[model samples]
Target: MFCNKMLELQRVYRQASLLALITIYYNLLEGAVSVWFGAGDETISLFGFGIDSFVEVISGVGIWHMVRRLGRGETADRDPFERQALRITGGAFYLLTAGLIATASASLFQGHQPQTTRWGIVISLISIVSMQALIHFKTKVGTALNSPAILADAACTRTCLRLSVVLLAASLGFQLTGIGSLDAVGSLIIAVLSFWEGREAFEKARGLGCGCSCGCTTSTKSDH
Candidate 1:
């Protein structure tokens, strides 16, 4: 029975590592493309979305390291690193929220109209489909593995899905209506959501329960 448990855990770790690597590569590509097109078109929402992707890369790499540590049987050394990652994730979100607010405000007030980019639509569509797939698989794996960190990471991925929706709506709205301010409005929404997520992540890291309905981070055991 002990041997069987060890094997099961090893399998979970392997799966986690694979998922983390996929996330890293996907985010890097998505971030690069979004940033490129967002800058070219001066769309605050796409630019912010691109920044979020890069932040997710950091998160994915952190998860990869945690999984590797688990594989190496170094469970005792994981808590501090997990805490730090949570803190960093929270901090990044706060910064992103602030930037989005400033940029969105400027766009709104300065009559900064954005041109429609074919790439924004393409990126948002790809992200929506891809992130949804990832959330499904990652949530399944995390539940099966009984890992809080993996579950938290899955939750984070869900937020990405929401962001993709906002991006798509903003991009499509602008493309269809020619209302350039729609992009800025969408960016403000993203900022509000990001701020909420950041506060939750930061609270969970401090052992203050994330307030998620799932109670995923109610305990001080671990977080992502």
Candidate 2:
């Protein structure tokens, strides 16, 4: 009976590891596509969203590492590598935020308009569906394993979902009204959220416990 339980635990851990890997790879693809299309279409919101995905890749790598350690029956405490990843992720997010804010401000000031927001609409729709599915599966696995780290990662994905929604709204609004400022406004919102995520990453790295907007504090407490 005990051996059966152990095998089950291993299987669940493997599933968690697989999910983390999927998140990392998916973000890479999404980021690349978003950046390419965003640049082609001159959509600041989509471009900023793509950069955000790249930052998420860094965070996803840390989650993958944590899963590996936990699979080995190690403690959930943030290790040196995870801490470093968090710091890097935080810095990247901050940089992205600043860039987006600056670019968005300039675009607004110049009354710059995107060539097209159709791609933004398409990308955001896909992201919404993908993030929702990931959240569902991650939450299921986290719950089954009673793993706070996994749950926290799942919570983090919600921020991605929110970004998608913002992108979609801005894209759709611009498409309907032929208003260019909508895109810049969306980029500004993304910058605000990215700034918040950066702060959360730094806090996590410092072992301050989760005060993330994603409501992960309840689950993350177990990690501390």
Candidate 3:
């Protein structure tokens, strides 16, 4: 019986580590595109897009830490450290979200509309779509594997996908209306959504000690 548990623990740790590596790699690519096109177009949405990718880097690190602490043998018996990391990431997400919204809103208020770049548009479109597919995959894999890290990774991906709607809207709005302010408004909306989702994750992580992803197998005090 103990052997089986240890084997499952090993599998979960490996999967979480894989997830972390993938996310970080994608984030780096995202950051590069955002920087290359953002300044040229002077678009807040595009620039903030980069920041959003970088933000996920922190979340990925948290998951990595969780995987490491939950590693082999004796350490496996210790409580999952990922929950505390999730709480911290959740709070940071909210704070960063507020900043994203404020900056976008302020830009809109100031009537700062930016020109769009073709590369930026293409990347954003591809990113949003690709992430949607990944989100679906994560959902399935996490459910099947029943790993908190997998679940948390999916949740983060979903959050980004949701925010992409606002981003796309702002991008198109600016393109059509010749007003950059729409971009800012879009950013503000993203911030609100981020805060709401982040807080939800925070509460779930704290109270349940789970990533709020489906199919959790962890035991609680009441369960014992």
What TM-score does candidate 1 reach? 0.86
Better of 2 and 3 by lDDT: 2
Model 3, which residues run further than 4 Å from truth? 1-16, 67-84, 117-120, 204-224
Q: Write the per-residue lDDT of candidate 2 for residues 1-224, one digit (tens) a residue.
A: 99998899889889999998999999999999999999999999999999999999998988899888888889888899989988998999999999999999999999999999999999999999999999999999988888878888889999999999999999999999999999999999999999989988898888765523243564453432
How many clashes show up in model 3? 1
By lDDT rank, best first, the candidates go 2, 1, 3
- Assess the local accuracy of residue 14 in candidate 2 as a C-alpha lDDT between 0 and 100: 94
* TM-score, cand. 3: 0.73
Total clashes for model 2: 0
When 1 and 2 are scored with lDDT, the better candidate is: 2
Q: Tell me the tens digit of each residue's lDDT in model 3 across 165-188.
A: 667777777777777677777667
lDDT of each: 0.77, 0.89, 0.64
In model 3, pairs of residues that clash are 113-180
Ranking by TM-score: 2, 1, 3
- Candidate 3 — what's its lDDT? 0.64
